[model samples]
Target: MASSPNIFGKAQADVLAETGTALLQIKNSRRLTLEDMARVLGRTDDMVAKYIAGEAEMGFVAFRRASEAWPELTEKLNGGAE
Candidate 1:
């Protein structure tokens, strides 16, 4: 099967990539391992890795879990000020 081009284009892709990197930074700052993140989000390590790699989008529930686990994540995502 063939895939269609991404309608969201480069800008959205860039944002997702930056988000992934930021999420990784947050995990690092928390001194968390991928396993720890998986437990926090109720996801498998592979899925967590994909979220941190920008290969998969975190759903609202996962996002909520992540934000709950790291309140600073919400601030950082909202542009580094709360």
Candidate 2:
């Protein structure tokens, strides 16, 4: 029988943490304030802060948009995964 892939594991947690950190780094490198990231992501500053703080995981759609918009940073965060 076919088996489902494990979606919740250390690897997933690592990916989330890495992605969150990379997002924050990108913002810093670009000299973008939290408000700037919020504007780019169409989210509130509080939400962007939460994302940067790793208090909230971005939904797949938002992640996709971010990945598309910032491929370099996303690639680093996602371990080069598309």
For candidate 1, the 10 contiguous residues with the lowest summed lDDT are: 3-12
| After superposition, candidate 2 runs with Cα above 4 Å error | 1-12, 80-82
> What are the lDDT scores of the predictions, listed in order?
0.80, 0.73
**Model 2 CA lDDT for position 68:** 73
List model 1 lDDT by residue over 1-82, tens digit each.
9553453454556656666887898888888899999999999999989888988878889989988888888777656853
**Structural similarity to truth (TM-score) of each candidate:** 0.78, 0.73
Give the residue spans of candidate 1 off by over 4 A: 1-10
lDDT of 2 by residue, 6-70 (tens): 35545555556676788888887778888887777878889888887777778877777677767
Clashing residue pairs for model 2: none
